[model samples]
Target: MKLSAFADVCLRTLMLLGSRPDQLITTREIAEQIGVPYNHVAKAVLELRNRQAIEVTRGRYGGSQISARGLQLAVGTLMRDLDVRDDVVDCVSETGVACPLIAQCTLRGALRRAREAFYAELDLLRIEDLTGPASRRLLPFPVLR
Candidate 1:
């Protein structure tokens, strides 16, 4: 399943924040790092915030930060949300109808199995796993400003 660019950005931003859990990253900073429009990043950040995947702080130094809850949600979960349902059906419905050989086709059965397997694999992965040790070592230092 293909993930939307916004979703990719969201995951990347979350991972970046996860790497530096002590720092609050602003939307402009995320946009600069990802080479995307700040508005786009803002939208994705908002969506993530709405989902409780990230926390948003409002102030002169307000910024976004990934919450423990967000870190628990895996990349797969985000991808799943971004995936287009039409694409899933497109793989099985070529002409808006079930395969003609539905009664005897093993291919369809196999496709179903493949889809299940895909989701199963995703289920095993968590957001924390994507952050890796490199990010952990880069945690930001506390600042008084």
Candidate 2:
């Protein structure tokens, strides 16, 4: 189960925000820090805001901040929002009329199990869990300003 680039961005953003719960981060800074396009960061931030995972503040000191619910929502929302097919066979398109062995293939089952395991691991973690001590140390400073 491959996660989308947007999901990666969202998670990274959330982790950064969660690490420093006291500070708001600008989209530009986030983009710079993550080495991603500014538009991509802005889009992800909007998506997260829509999902209520983050709040957007607009003003002289406006920026993005993570909410408690956002931390909780981030755990499984990305995987849930991802476009994943349950049938591995359906995901493959070939000249042949699909693999006949697909119905009996353990590969599909294994893939499903692996996907479930991946989500299960994600479910066990929260945004706060991903933040390191370094992030905590950085939290006190108003870096976004």
Candidate 3:
């Protein structure tokens, strides 16, 4: 199943924050480091703040940092919460038409299970896991893991 761009941004933001737990990062800095737009990072920051996954401070010299809750949060749980996209299969036809077999198609159910399984696999790891040496390398900045 494809994740929404919003979800992708949230994950990326989380990864960056997790990488440098001691530093408070601004949206612009996060955008620059993650190679995403400032607006996008701002939006992600707002949502993450709302979710209490990260703490935000507003003012000059204000920024955000990962919350204690964030580090222990399961990756799959966060993904599931942030991944509020449509079903994996809309079972629809081209030209904005709905498929006729939607009523009885088992394919939709199967695909749903597949998506759940994917999240289940992700449940094995937490945000802390993503801040390891390898993942730290993925970040644009140097980090001590």
Candidate 4:
């Protein structure tokens, strides 16, 4: 399943933070590094903070950092937390539209299994895994403010 841009941004933010655990990283910094908009990054960061995946501090010398809790969280869990459910078939839509094949659709089950398998693979990885040496090299050190 294709992750939403929001979820991708959130992961990118976390990966960046994980690289610099000693410093409080700002949303602007994250947006700049990831090439996402500030407002979008801000919203994602807020959600991460609300979920306790990241910690936010206010006032001077305050920014945001990934919490230890976030480091241990499975990537799939984080993705699920950030995902906005998109029904793969009309039968799954909350609109309650009745489908003729609802009683005999094997496709839905197959799709569901495929989606679950995707997340299951991700579940094997933690946030820390994404911040390892190979991945860290992809994210250069952020420029000074």
Candidate 5:
């Protein structure tokens, strides 16, 4: 299952934060390092903060950091938190209509299982796991303001 753009940003932001662990990264800094728009990263940061995955401070010297609570979380659990959608497929039409084939379609069932499998595999990993040496090397360090 392909994660939503929002979820992607959330994961990338967390991964970047996890790499540093101690540094409080600003939203703009996260966007620049991850190649995402600051606005998008800001929104993702707010959501993550609300979920307690990250902590945000206001005013001068304020920025975001992954919470100790965040460190122990499974990647899949966070992904699920960020990905609020219940189904991999819409099973609905764009014009406010439900798919007529919803009842008889075996494809949806198969897709559901596949999606669950994808997340299940991700469940094997924690946010801290992504911050290990090998993965950290792939992430860019935050630049000074």
Candidate 6:
């Protein structure tokens, strides 16, 4: 399954922070490097801070950095937290339309299993995995991985 743009941004933000464990980086810097809007980065930063996945320092020299826990955070858990929508299936849509096969659909179960398997695979990864040589090469700043 393809990840939403917001989720991709969140993961990119984590990777940026993870690549530079010793220094704090600003949202604008992240946006510039990742080629996303500053406002999008800001929103992602705030969400990460709220989830305790990253720490933010507010001041003239304010910036954000990944937390220790965030570095070790399982990709599966992060995905679950960031992709908090229950409408993976058409039957689960918030819209009031009722599907005739809702009571007998095997597709729902299959989809659920597929999603679980996806998460299970993601669980094996950590933020460090994303900040490897390839990521460093792609990012604008010098990432010491």
TM-score per candidate, in order? Answer: 0.72, 0.77, 0.89, 0.86, 0.88, 0.87
Per-residue alpha-carbon lDDT of model 3 for 1-145, expressed as tens digits? 6667777788889989999998989999998898878888899999999988899988998899999888888988888988765678656677888998888889888888899899999999998899877998877843211
**Would you list the rank order by TM-score, best first?**
3, 5, 6, 4, 2, 1
lDDT of candidate model 2 versus the reference: 0.73
TM-score top scorer? 3
* Candidate 6: residue 77 lDDT (0-100): 84
- Candidate 2 lands at a TM-score of 0.77
TM-score of candidate 1 on Cα atoms, chains taken together? 0.72
Candidate 2 lDDT tens digits, 1-145: 6676777777777877887677888998778876677888899899889988889999888999988887666466466565355653464557647766766878878877777777877777777767768666653333221
TM-score of candidate 3 to 2 decimals: 0.89
Candidate 5 Cα deviation (angstroms), residue 119: 0.7
Candidate with the larger TM-score of 2 and 6: 6
| Residue-level lDDT tens digits of model 1 in 1-145 | 5546776677777877777677898998877766677887899899889999889999899999989998898666677776655334443565677666757867656765776678668878778886789655653322111
| Model 6 misplacement above 4 A | 92-95, 140-145
Deviation in angstroms for 15 in model 1? 1.1
Q: Which ten-residue region of model 4 has the weakest summed lDDT?
A: 136-145
The total number of steric clashes, by the backbone 3 Å criterion, in model 1 comes to 0
The CA lDDT at 39 in model 5 is: 89
Model 5 TM-score (2 dp): 0.88
- Give per-candidate clash totals: 0, 1, 0, 0, 0, 0
User: Cα lDDT of all candidates, in order?
Assistant: 0.73, 0.73, 0.85, 0.83, 0.86, 0.84
| C-alpha lDDT of residue 47 in model 5 | 90
Q: Which wins on lDDT, candidate 2 or candidate 3?
A: 3
Model 5 lDDT-worst window of ten? 136-145
True-structure RMSD for candidate 4? 4.2
lDDT of model 5 at position 140: 72
Best model per lDDT = 5
